[model samples]
Target: MVKSGKTKKKYHKPTKPHHHLNPPPAQANKPISVKTLPAHLVLEILYRTPVKSLVRFKSVSKSWFALINHPTFIKMHLDFNTSKNDKNKLICSCGYGTFIDIALLSLSEEPMNVLRINKDFTERPNYPRKINFRDFSKNMVLAGSVNGIVCLSHSEEMSERFVVLWNPSICCWCPIALVETKSWDNMSVGIGFDEVINDYKVICIVPEFRFEDYGWSRIEVYSTNQGSWEDVDKKGKIHFRPNTDLNHCNFIVNGVPYWAGLDLRPGYVDVLGRIDPFTGLFKKIEHPKHVRNEITRVNPVKLRESVAALIQSPGDYPNNVIDLYLLDENTTKWTKMYSIGPLVSGNVCEEMQIPQCFSTGEIILETWTWDTDQDHVTDLDLVHNIYDPKTKLVLHINHMQALHPCWYESYSHVESLVCIKGMVQIGKEHRDKKTKPKMKNWTEFLSKEFDSVLHL
Candidate 1:
């Protein structure tokens, strides 16, 4: 009885309510602190990123957005990508009607393929269709591309011609004021950037009409910084005939525009004219000796910081040879760097159009071929040949089979964050004022179809 009583007497303290008590500290998990990188270091890393990545990264933060959109950052990114040879997408336009198809070509892959299709700029639904045939030709000419901006004219001969500066990368466009010109004129327009003024310029060359024949050209320039067109002085006007093939003949190299120049007069050699973007003045440079006599086509391309010309000529039976000449800016001399074959057998390339050249010495050639016996152009053999200068190996890519080459027009484009409206703000805006409405109708239709399939 005594033992039982002693054991039962032991009592526990009453439990207390701890409702207002403080919680235990977060278990020694690593202390959370955001370690922001230095601004310059962050910018250096962003500059090395791809343009598409940069565009998407704009949503990261306010500071990141501002850094990506800064002019200095944009230029630094461009220069960095250019140095790395990362900005080498070829944009090609095919077919002309109510809608056009613009395909982005990727040569970075082993077998080049279409990277993306941009129908937004091609489908100019707001454009007036009542324009005349001549006007239509001028508007759809696809003058050329420079630093991701493309220039298009609507009226070449009229006093008031409508022009568009479009940046396909951002899907933004600006219509330039009507460009005024003289009567009975043939005009060639080229757009380029001026590093000196840090502005974009448009060069218009109208050949003088002399007794129903082409003669000395009158040059006019439009500066985006000034937002007006001005006449180039007589000294700045070139005497040679402008190349009719503006798409292939005109190119921008190191912020200057180069065009294939020809003098119909006897003993006058064909030259490459370099137009100064700031002053509108031009200087003629001699062509390489080998391709001077039998030049079928001349493509001026960017080679390093200077310029290079791709010259093509007919070779032995069922073959063609392409020669690449680089210009020494100091001496103004042409030095031959590469000589691509007498292409492979059975592949007769009639017209060789070079869209781009990589710093790795790879040349992307777009060619059109014809049947030897039929003497007519054949669309079956539309191919893009990538020639490696070091190995002299050619990789044939059948572009026609994939893109159905209907009036193929290709240009080398470097993707950029440049705003067309920023460059030409005086003109009407082409970008939609608001974001495009979500495809509600299509989404609903697809959902209903899926439900029906599930029930079935």
Candidate 2:
């Protein structure tokens, strides 16, 4: 009846389902529970992990990788490894490359055990026999160690040289060209951390050789982030010797590098030069009045398993007596701490200063003096001695003819001597004292304490 007209109930399209276009509530993207893990628990877990895991963990998840990659985390891992008893490791470099030998030295009533680090160990890394030189010479300088990362630099070859950076822990290396080789001088390289930039820097100092510009030195700094070397402008009256001994001129402290020089005057007085990576500037640092004379050599040392130091010595060759100066992080001051004495002539004849020092107030030393009168080359009085500066005691540790590298790593602690094929731990053989003194051979006694690091 209707006017067929009226739309037979015009039907609107079925109402579309009103599903919101928003993502499914973000799946409650809750953060990881790393924050919930107790600091001690997290540190404990990290302690059992190796450096490679730590480096890779940074990308696992923002929270995880960040927590694990933090410098603080690395530091915590180091502290935990160190505190778990005295883990001593001896690292050496020779024609064969760098080798690390681990020994356990527990402070308490634990027995000494020599733990073996297999080529496959998680914490230990094996290096190639002949490390390829990136751009420079065959020689490399072991600059400093921080959080298990050993910093090193390559010297320019006498023929053609380049500089490189390496971290032994992770087996990471980067070689870079020396920007200002035009001077054709044997350049010097130094590495340290620049706090201002929170980056590590490598400094190369090329002494200007032209007689006209006698004391002038051209300096360049390599920044890791920038991946380039930049020349630093500095004004100082420096005297140049065509072939001067440049080894002692540069040193690293608390991540900053320093250069040592003399007055540059007629008879230049020894001057210590420091480079501030932040300002890219160089300034002379006055030595403690006590260290003025004495053909001094300033170099870095592993003050402990974790700390870096500037070790000053009047001399390390042939001198039976050696003194140590530790770098103070807060003050940037070199504190003269201990001396290995005038050994009764027969007791010790020749000595090589061991560069490693530990907070335990113990130091490792090496010597090669012999009474047999054997040819200097053949004569073997090589002895590794543990010197306790706190107690004024020195114990013969190991012996060899000519110890190579002279420095190496130990577990969480720095090690000096181990019974490697070419090396020998002769401490047990030379028990000279039939009578046990009060202090006794605590050094030898330490061996009986913690033999090796083993997991229970």
Candidate 3:
């Protein structure tokens, strides 16, 4: 070794590793970067996700925000959800005599399959996720539900009735012009979609009250696209009734609303009434001959694409079968589809104390026992049963009893993005910031599922 005046260079190791050893394998459990995913694939995964999850993802990036908010994407999401039976739900109102709580029941495909897979019925489905209605309305009637939008009508007896179109999935509401109810009674409210106009419309069929006026309902329609209400029918020919229960499905067919009402003519005739969504015109339909002579009340329900009647067979008090008759819209006649016997015999759809066969082909029977005198409901006993058409067996889901009035009625619901255009301001969560629970600073970065990495 030679020693020079200059300091010797410090020894250092080379960065290149030996060729004998291979680099450690990439982490097997590592998450894939969203950047690596094609935008179309990312969209495919996202639109199928639950709405709650999608809401949180809006802050991800500008491209994501645009994609999620696009009208085409929203429609695609709604279509995908509707196509999947498991994604269907029912918006319900339940309470005792006084207070009603709105809840969402998961009408899953699995439960229907359970009737086949589990013969013993040991397995129970997890359903009926509870949602608070206090934020929405109190004592308001659920006028109708369409594509996840609920029409909430609040009317004091003999006063003005206001209607609100609420999309619970997105927690946004659009209020329609109020209907002056001081001059109207026996109002029938319905909500449906209009494919021709590509808009959602809410209709109110109410009879104008006058000293000399006979009982005939006038048709008024509120178009969401217009954001205004228009009285379409002035002839006052037919009258339909609402504000009773969650059986509103009995009134709507193929986005058209129908009701069993009276036609005001020389002599009052019981007629099946419907409102043409496109024309906003009122028309009268006749009851099936099988149901007309029976003297038993019939339920006008949406069957396939037309209106159908569920008629009790023979006599009402003592009956052995119930017939389902489909309507030939063009002929204005009824054709018998099938007869439900022994399994669903002697039951009326609205007496509601008896079993009712729905267009979904399930015979559902719900019973409620209320403890009341002159005041509010103190306690309740509710039992719900389902009759499987295929198996011809009735499943007594359970006999549930609860304190306080817990009477709940479920209406048709679909998970959708409608009524959410430029209107997704966070609901109670953002409105009640002071009441929100205190979360850790670090936890804010984590995704809702906790499986996600820090968003920021």
RMSD to true structure for each model, in Å: 11.5, 20.8, 12.3
**Runs with alpha carbons beyond 4 Å of true place in candidate 3:** 1-35, 107-136, 155-159, 179-186, 231-250, 266-268, 291-295, 303-306, 343-360, 367-382, 399-409, 420-456
**TM-score per candidate, in order?**
0.71, 0.56, 0.69
List of clashing residue pairs for candidate 3: 95-405, 95-406, 96-405, 96-406
TM-score of 1: 0.71
Query: Mind giving the per-residue lDDT tens digits that candidate 1 earns over 381-423?
Result: 5666678776789886655345555535455567777774344
lDDT per residue (tens digit) for residues 165-184 in model 2: 54444344555555443653
Off by over 4 Å in 2: 1-40, 52-92, 95-139, 146-149, 155-161, 234-251, 259-261, 286-320, 323-339, 372-378, 399-456
Give the per-residue lDDT digits (tens) of candidate 3, residues 397-446.
53222212343334556767665322334334234445766434433433
Worst 10 residues of 2 by lDDT: 416-425
User: Per-model C-alpha lDDT, please?
Assistant: 0.62, 0.47, 0.57
Q: Highest TM-score: which candidate?
A: 1
**What's the lDDT for residue 264 in model 2?**
60
**Cα deviation of 222, candidate 1, in Å:** 1.0
Model 3 alpha-carbon miss at residue 39, Å:
3.1
Task: Kindly provide the TM-score of model 3 when superposed on the true structure, using C-alpha atoms.
Answer: 0.69
